[model samples]
Target: MREEFGSGAAGGAAAGAGERGPVVVALSGGADSLALAAAAAYVGERDGFAAAAVVVDHGLQAGSDRVAERAASQARGLGLEPVLVRRVAVRESSEAGGPEAAARDARYAALARAAREIGAAVILTAHTRDDQAEQVLLGIARGSGARSLSGVPPRRELGDGLVVLRPFVRADPSITRAVTEAACREAGLDAWRDPQNADPAFARARVRASVLPLLERELGPGVAAALARTADLAREDAEAFDAMVAEQIEEIVEHAEAGIAVSVAALAANPAALRHRIIRRVAEAEFGRELSREHTLAIAALVTHWRGQGPVEVPGITVSRAGGRIEFARRTGSPRRRRGCADGDRAEGGGARGVAGTPEAMEE
Candidate 1:
């Protein structure tokens, strides 16, 4: 366990903590989080760095405050300093993506606030291999592309100079939920189990309770590990593709009047995968919208199969071809026009006017 904790990004952060703020563990009193707290406390002491814990109470369940307090107490017992407990209100309706996703957003926001208050540079989350497997399976069920299948990354920047790290999830041996529970038991800690984990109303709960088990039973075991491995490989590919897009996007993209424009010739020059990614990347980076696979392909068709197709209206943006460039503008902005051509130049001979639906698109 020490070897596992003393490796990876968490280990590197701990080694360099002398010049930075303390490392914080996100504690929920669950088995995985409890085990993480224990490992962090021990490793921090041995490595001469400050370790702390933050417990976030969503207040979704009755007695959630008590649960938070118990977790805080456990953190204190583990010799962690300045344990903090935060209670956050989850706004389900206002937040996009379902209740679970909304709750998660709120929880992470609270965690980020806590980190800021304490001057913490790194926040450790105890998402195990099981969680990774579940995320990949969920991505597959949604027919998502490589990005979604990549699952949660090992580390992501939460704020300026602050990052959230999942040590157990990306561990070489891949710590499992059962392993965390055993660790908690060995340490004489009574871990709290969230009932929502097994509730049927949630997609993740259904995947954990039914889908994964069925796959493991029929496939003769190791299915979960394989899924987690798949996430690692997918993440590598996604990262490489993202880097390539970053390198070429500025060269191909240009700001138009009240909109953005891409070189149609440039887009057509790339392969389908790269072309689609570039289209989605434009919408995401400029307009804060995620384009679905169907939407991306539809937008791609304007460049690849151009027979003077009209503007393709996706959520929040309208994509259209004008001469040698593809224009993207806000849906509510001025109507798109073909450059160097007459005003309102519709598709030649009225080619198919592509209008994408509003359904959330799969990520690439």
Candidate 2:
């Protein structure tokens, strides 16, 4: 963890430049976000990005509103104006699916709206390299294939002309926590921890609370560093692969009444790895969300068992084949009733739930 805090803190990630414009900090009251808010406010003032903060209250607990208010106060303490805090709803789905994911969806949706209302150019998050490693592990657990394992990007376009930048994805979580602690000490403050962090039922909680510690014991130090480095390498591989796939996409994929269609024969001609990559991407472009490595193999069943009908659902999306082209379409409607697939999260997408950090390796 590498961090400097308070008046002496290094700085926040650049949120563009202007003599007078705002950068909205999506402060979650967590150490990473608190650090990000303070750093942004400090740097924003000097670097032309007027720092504004928004703390979303999911209302999941008794003291959520208080937390938001305190977060707002902390933002003001950093020379920022009063923060705009909003209360959002988090509806629960199935037991396994739960409300946490929905809370995140609702939270980000509010933040996006907040950023738009204030005309802020950038939305900064507090995702650190450790988080990225957990994501890669979670992707592995789901057998989500290579792209999911690559983890989050440092800079990505959010909806409505907002860009989300994660400056600490290259840094460790401890660094930001240290900074936040230093800042809080200076201000005489305390922090809250989410109970979800210790819930063994959630895979990520187990990874963070158990597996990470075990790795430290067995691997003898540098375990987190190793995982973080793995994320970097996977990210590089995924980026290069996407670029190549984009170039050859026209050669392999085409629009059809069935939505995006891929030539199964063309796919078969590529190496096994490239074929799986093409399948995962084609699935996303046409149906939203990725096809797991297991699902990708099932997709190949369309080629191996192509006769009349070879169709199966890949969780949120459906895969089928007609003639020489493999077709992936959203399962919500038939071809007669379909218009298009929504732009999905690169790693995971469902109609209701956006892709988030889910940590592990999965195989079929």
TM-score for each of the candidates: 0.89, 0.80
Clashing residue pairs, candidate 1? 292-361
Candidate 2 per-residue lDDT over residues 34-115, each given as its tens digit:
7777767667666655778889999988888988888888778877654899999888655224455667667778988988
Please provide, for model 1 over 1-364, each residue's C-alpha lDDT reduced to its tens digit, 9 standing for 90 to 100.
Answer: 4455445324544743556878889999999898888888877877888888999999999999999999999999999998999999888753245566566778888888888888888888988889888888878767778998998788888658888888887676668898888878888988999998898887678889999999989997999999999999999999999999997797999999869999988998898888999999999999998776767888999988888767886767888898899999888643455664353323121122221110122111
- Model 1 misplacement above 4 A: 1-16, 333-364
User: Where does candidate 2 stray beyond 4 Å?
Assistant: 1-12, 15-20, 94-96, 171-183, 186-189, 304-323, 327-364
The candidate 1 region of ten consecutive residues with least summed lDDT is 355-364
Indicate the residue-level lDDT of 188 in model 2.
Answer: 52
